[model samples]
Target: MSGPGYRRVAVPVDGGDLAVGVWEPAGETKGTALLVHGVTSSHLAFTHLARRLPGLRLIAPDLRGRGGSHAVRGPAGMEAHARDLVAVLDAFGLESVPVVGHSMGAFVAVVLAHRAPDRVTGLVLIDGGLPLAAPAGLSAEDTVAAILGPTAARLSMRFRDVDAYLDFWHEHPAFAGRWTRELEAYFAYDLVPGDGGLRPATSYATTVDDTIDLTTGDALREALASLDTPTLMLTAPRGLLDEEPGLYEESRLATMLAGLPAVRHQRVEGVNHYTLVMSPEGADAVAPAVAGVLAGERSTA
Candidate 1:
């Protein structure tokens, strides 16, 4: 298969390089889009989304430590992620670009809009933005244990071959029945030979620290409530959470998000956390939602 309309560009951030991939539209770009991948995912996750939106120039960055990006040797958090995104925009000589973020990337987008309002024209948040409210009294270790199963396993294995790494993801609950060559290539991109075989480039430590910070974060609601940037939040009905049959749990997330004045939230009919970004279903469903937001922003501009 052909690679993404892809090219690697670097931005200086905290004395390190921010590796980003660009997908130029086939024709005129409706608008330039800057995309941020979810936790532990790379720019590859946006291939389907890029394929779907041929009218927009898309840039997908490998956040700090994932994919081809180098990890910071010092401390980092969501704020750092936002700053790196700003750096990317600056390097490209872009101003007031529309930003599309998935999962953890969405959280970063929220913070970016809140902190750097002038730099953003509009925002599209996919399957995230709500405060990661854990059940009260859940310990950091408990949350880590609960969420780190896949990370731990992914990081633990040292694969001599990429196929071994692909096999692991092929059997994962999230990818069950959703496997495709694109997905496999994405999984392959996450590995590098280490110790004896391949391991994920995203440090297990970063994943753990990020999870704790995300779940414990208290500022998202406050951030969204204060931001004036026109925003759209799209979530999946069965996001990393189990819900009662036939219930639209994502709509509940959307309802909660409705509190933000300039924010409009919606739940796509059939999608989940991972598939919400990687599959054709995800791209088809999300493109129009995002296009609608960009169109609205253009009209008002």
Candidate 2:
């Protein structure tokens, strides 16, 4: 399907290149937004959001060990991911800009704003940012498995062809009844030929490292503790599997926000964690808050 056009750039980093997808506004740009995707997703995941906000220049990057940057070696984690974001900004000659992240990307955005506050003007976190509750005594690997579920499992699975991969996602709980051509593009971009078949572009090992860091490491805590930038978090009522009481429990989220009064919270209805930014309805629910945040206005849904 036809949509907003974007240009790709390969930003040089320490280990390898970070692939950045840049979308420029049709006319004059209102501002710039750096879009970060979730653990097992890619830069193309922002297609819907980019189309929704045509006035803003959107910059999305395939983080190390994911998407076109799959060859990028790492010790992947929030800190390292944050550093790669800084490199993307530097490559574009941007000193600071509003940062928007979804799911795991939310953790990366917080760490970026925390570590390089001078490089971020504001933050919009969709369906993530706050610490996730992990059961005591769970190892990092186990935590990744539990949190990601089928999404993680797909990383190791091989597909006979592109259509086979599409069929798999067609049945995903999060995308059920909401699939669109935009999503098809995003999914198709995730495939890479390997071992006489196709596999997801994101590295399973990298996802594991990132999951452990966000859930168990101290970087997120430090980032949240020192959060000074204007931050807004939008949560989905459902999760990846379309289950109730998504990623963050309501009462638990309230308690977490009680400490960081500066970060405002808003609930977006009818969308799951994945659709919060990937679906048209989800983008409609989110674009306003994102625009409001960038415009220096507080928005609620």
Candidate 3:
């Protein structure tokens, strides 16, 4: 399927510029959605999801330290990222919109809604947002290592060419049996020419800082405590590596969600962390739920 067409916009923020991709609907827009990508991913990650929701105006931003915004110099954490998201809204003249976030971006979305509740109408957290279990006594860096595993390791490696980088991801367990043109385009956009090689556009230092905050910081915890916006959490059965027992294990997810009655949960079968937003099947499952949330918001308005 052909994805929605998007125009790139540069939104200025405190430390630097945030690159945003704006996708207008084919007809009258039912509502607006602010789509946020995962850690180490760019706005391109939302292409599949955009195609699934052609009636909604989609605004996706390449957060600081990633994609075209890799040059955005500043401290990296949930608060800074949340602030940048607000800037994105201001630049686009959007007073409030439903925010959709995937993976680490889900955590950022929660913080955004918490810090700027007036700017968010609702939230859709795909494959993330709930607290994760981390081992006790591990340093921040070590915790990141344990949580991310190979996904973290790829940030330090360099590919000789774009083809080489594509080859690397062609074997990633998450993309196994699910590669498509959309996925290819997303991956290709992540590479940039470096000294003697091609490197992912995401900054490793920024990723580490952000990862530490999402994993160990108190911001997300506090955000969940007072979460008043209508929220939906879609979880994949598998994980980043296509490993069984995805990010939020069944019992643990239940335990974590017990306190947040406002947030709804759904299990999307047959997809993993990356596919939950990057593949057609994943988009099919998510788009309808998002539409329902938008409809609910309109009814209550």
Identify the runs in model 1 with alpha carbons over 4 angstroms from their true place.
1-4, 147-153, 218-221, 241-255
**Model 2 global lDDT (CA atoms, 0 to 1):** 0.89
For model 2, residues 91-157, the per-residue Cα lDDT tens digits are: 9999888899999999999999999998988889999899987776887678888888898988999
lDDT of 3: 0.89
- In angstroms, give how far residue 67 of model 1 lies from its true place: 1.1
The candidate that achieves the highest TM-score relative to the unseen native structure: 3
TM-score against native, each model: 0.89, 0.96, 0.97
lDDT of each: 0.75, 0.89, 0.89
* Regions of model 3 farther than 4 Å from truth: none
lDDT (10s digit) by residue, model 1, range 15-128: 578778898855566888889888788998998888777677888899887788846555556777888898999888888888899988888888888888898888898877
> Residue 294 of model 1: what lDDT?
74
Model 3, range 1-301, lDDT digits (tens) per residue?
Answer: 6556679999999888988998886668888889999889999898877888877899999999999899998898999999999999998899999999999999999999999999999999998898877787887678878888888788888999878988999999888889898777888888887877988999888888988898778899899989988899999999989999999999999988898997999999999988988888998999998888889889999
Q: Specify the poorest-scoring 10-residue window by lDDT in model 3.
A: 1-10
Worst 10 residues of 1 by lDDT: 239-248
State how far residue 261 of model 2 sits from its true place (Å).
1.3
lDDT of 3 at 279: 88
